[model samples]
Target: MRIPAFLLAFSVLGGCAGGMSKDECLYADWRAIGYEDGARGASASAVSSHRQACAKKAGITPDMNAYLAGRDAGLREYCQVSNAFSIGARGGRYYGVCTGPEEGAFVTAYQQGNQLFALENDLAHAEHAFAAAEKRLQEINHNIDHAEAALISPATPHLERVDILADLKNLNEEKQRVKRSFGPLRRDIDVAYEELADYRAFLAANGPYPGAHSVTSASY
Candidate 1:
């Protein structure tokens, strides 16, 4: 069987990394996993079937450990491919995608994929919270503005003026709390976006992820 030139180079590098040749490591096999740019439209069971089909074509052993590992290795290779484009040169230079070996790459790939997923979920949740908070702040601002307008009127009664002043003070305190929350909330969102963008770049350049995409509910 003829191996790709990239795989040959990967093997040479792997040897320097104190590992087996890329061929022995299954790096090429890992990269061979489809990085579908489009969503898998298939159901979970169907996707599993597709994985089986891929495994068969790749000549991977049927052992569960090896199967799962290969899937993870594929994810890492996909990330590497995606990141290459994201970090590429302005003139359109790109990194060569790895397509060799299988050894320990799967573990790291699977772990990073899972971590990225968790970060994405957290980001989604934070966005919802931020939206709610922003809406509330806008409402408060409107109320405060109306109150200030009333306070400026010559016809404003003493009792009513006192009430408006108190309300303003309370709103200011609430705004301060909201302001404090924004720092952390924004940080969380930023982290999530970074991780997600990395994953997305990987997918765009490489292909679709192995599993399902996350879905967020409107009310969440």
Candidate 2:
């Protein structure tokens, strides 16, 4: 059975920083470990990490030739164009593993997917800012209403009424400023949404990678 790209990528990239446990080092399959690391696009220094871990815990050394051979084989699977897009779209980092003829296409797809990732973040930030502004405006309006009521109260103390009047003036000014901010905030949100939509459409039509299906909401 085939694995979903996201899940595969997650498995490859997740929980990869730790050193081998004592048990793991004692009964290690160096080649398999190397293959797993390479499939995740780990740096070449991964073998050094494994060597250090094993030497410290198990008093053993990794088979250098076996590890390199396995890593090379795994890199062939990892450096595919489609995999690059999948990784990049998920905001996963690339380790510069692809080389030779396939490198150009793989890099291109990765960059394209990365663009989509960036656009998604941009839209999210824009929407968040707009929402925050709207909330602040609501709060300002509420404060203004309360201040206005306090200023006009018939039995209010003279000194308190003066303070309330001053507050009302400041609140009105702040409300106007917040109201004016709405225009630019809304424009920012609209522009971000449109830019993200346009990029998504472009990817859908052009395909994120060769032989891949059209981009969809799930792709993000």
Candidate 3:
């Protein structure tokens, strides 16, 4: 479920393009905007986006001092290890917002959660590939049946029958190849499942972390 980096960049650019509306800029609370951004773990420089938006839309400049103060307060709410882990578990990108003594612990927890995300992603991919292979095998079998029936039919032309025989041979070979893939694919899925389960158990045993509501409701 992780978003691609390029897509994330595109979303950011898209947001910039749609920036603040004139009404929003006219009535903006820079401190609150800063707080929201900080709580979301955006970099301090994100204020520049607001500045540009307000400037373009309403000819108003953001109050830098108030915004930075609110952002600092908001960062306190966002830079928790528990929040970092939750973000990583959900396949969210970290923007290196946490710093000082907290950064190490935050990064470590995020890495562990990201590992779980990787396992989940791998299992999903394996399952999809297995399903695709099975579907192809079924299609190949169906084609072989039709080819076999055609080859035996009295009305089938001699030249067409020869071509059908060759097609049938190729289909059977491809079916075997597809069948051979099942073992490895299943093994990959099983391994991924086990890894995911183990990680979940490890997190459960070690955590009584703050709940989502508590994390989100924290004061800026």
Highest TM-score: give the candidate number.
2
User: What's the ranking of the predictions by lDDT, best on top?
Assistant: 2, 3, 1
Q: What's the count of clashing pairs in each model shown?
A: 18, 0, 0
Q: Write the per-residue lDDT of candidate 2 for residues 29-143, one digit (tens) a residue.
A: 7777767777777888888778887888888888888888878877877888878887788798998988999899999999988888888888889889889888998998899
lDDT of 3 by residue, 1-220 (tens): 2223553444456434236799988887878767667666786678777888788888998888888887787777778876777677778878898888878888887886677777779888989999999999999989988999999999999999889989988999999999999999999889887877776666665552433222221121
**Model 2 CA lDDT for position 32:** 74
Judged by lDDT, which candidate is best? 2
Per-prediction CA RMSD (Å): 16.7, 3.4, 6.9
lDDT of each: 0.50, 0.80, 0.75
In candidate 2, which residue pairs clash? none
Score every model by TM-score.
0.39, 0.79, 0.78
- Lowest lDDT 10-mer window, candidate 2? 1-10
Deviating ranges (above 4 Å) for candidate 2: 1-14, 56-60, 145-170, 211-220
For candidate 1, the lDDT comes to 0.50
Model 1 regions lying over 4 Å from their true place:
1-118, 200-220
In order of TM-score, best first, we have 2, 3, 1
